[model samples]
Target: MAAVELHVDNRLLDDFEAIRPKLNGHEIGRRSSPVSDDVTVLTMEMVTAPSHARTMEVTLRRVDDQLRVGEIHYWDEHGIFIVPEVPFREVAG
Candidate 1:
């Protein structure tokens, strides 16, 4: 598969960083795909154990010329889980 580059702003990265500690696994890799001109979906591959893994997806939307995390999703053995938007905050300039 071909790789697509996802351009994200500093605030989005900062928000992801804030929630990193809460995630169940260590991030192994990440990839992003543009859903539209205003939206992009970032998928992170995580490893919880030597043979166990999970995936997390973060949907980013552009509003007022700034990219903000709109939603988060996680997939595990149980099923897909939708994460709340409360953990993400808009950073001040």
Candidate 2:
């Protein structure tokens, strides 16, 4: 799959980079897969200290020059599913 261009102004892009160190070394749990002609899904697995792991799924949609993050999901050892909280939307961007 082709690499998608991300905008420097995107909030999620910054958030992901900012947390990179805390994650230790991240893993690409799933490669980018096409969900539609304009959208693709990618999953990253992160390991927290001591032994906990978190899987984050990010759905990207092509919008002009940027691959906008349309959805996000987080899962951990407790079987708890968490998502980024947005004020007015059901999905995280």
Candidate 3:
């Protein structure tokens, strides 16, 4: 699989870097497998701290110089801190 360019701007990258230390370093780990011509599935495995594993899949669409992120859906294992169910930062209960 070839590496694709990210569509986001530099500021997003900078922001990600700024808070890099806080994240567990597993939020954006992606793996890819080919499905057919012009179609590929990306598997993003997420580990939400202490001990958990969740995976998500997103479709890729090729358009000239860039690959667009298309149709994202996931098989969530529902870890302690990921997605809409949990907050990015924990609130005192």
Candidate 4:
């Protein structure tokens, strides 16, 4: 995981709907994996018209019975981009 930050342009956010995360290509809710002991990797996909799509690989780690985001990797027309932890943040005043 590299120290990186990404901000989605307003145009892309307005064009695509980001759906739920998918584990092993299946949509999941709340808990990611049936086996809690294993590290879970989920893919979140957003798509828009004209064959444009973005896929984000989210890595989760178990922490005292709770799952926490570990690393994130995003894929788009520009290729893969990685962030060490949480990728998005609200702008400070």
Q: Which residue pairs collide, candidate 1?
A: none
Which model, 1 or 2, shows the larger TM-score? 1
For every candidate, C-alpha RMSD to the true structure in Å = 12.5, 12.6, 11.4, 14.4
Candidate 1 lDDT over 1-93, as tens digits, reads 111123344446666665556544444444354443543344333333212224345576767865665654555445544343356688999
Compute each candidate's TM-score over C-alphas.
0.32, 0.31, 0.28, 0.30
Please give the range of 10 consecutive residues that has the lowest summed lDDT in model 4. Answer: 44-53
Going through the candidates in the order shown, the clash numbers are 0, 0, 0, 0
Provide the overall lDDT of each model, using Cα atoms, as 2-decimal numbers: 0.45, 0.42, 0.36, 0.37
Give me the runs in candidate 2 sitting further than 4 Å from their true place. 1-53, 83-93
Q: Give the TM-score of candidate 1.
A: 0.32
Better of 3 and 4 by TM-score: 4
Order of models, best TM-score first? 1, 2, 4, 3
Global local distance difference test of model 1 = 0.45
Worst 10 residues of 2 by lDDT: 1-10
Compose the digit string of candidate 3's lDDT tens values, residues 1-93: 112212223334444344334433333332233333432232322333222334433354656754554543333255233343444787899
**Which of the numbered candidates is closest to the native, going by highest TM-score?**
1
Candidate 4 per-residue lDDT over residues 1-93, each given as its tens digit: 211223333343322223223222332222234444343323332231113324454455667865555654555456644332446888999
Please write out the lDDT profile of model 2 over residues 1-93, one tens digit for every residue: 112222122335445564444443453443333443333333333332223324445455657764555654455557566544457857867
Sequence-dependent TM-score of model 4? 0.30
| True-structure lDDT of candidate 4 | 0.37
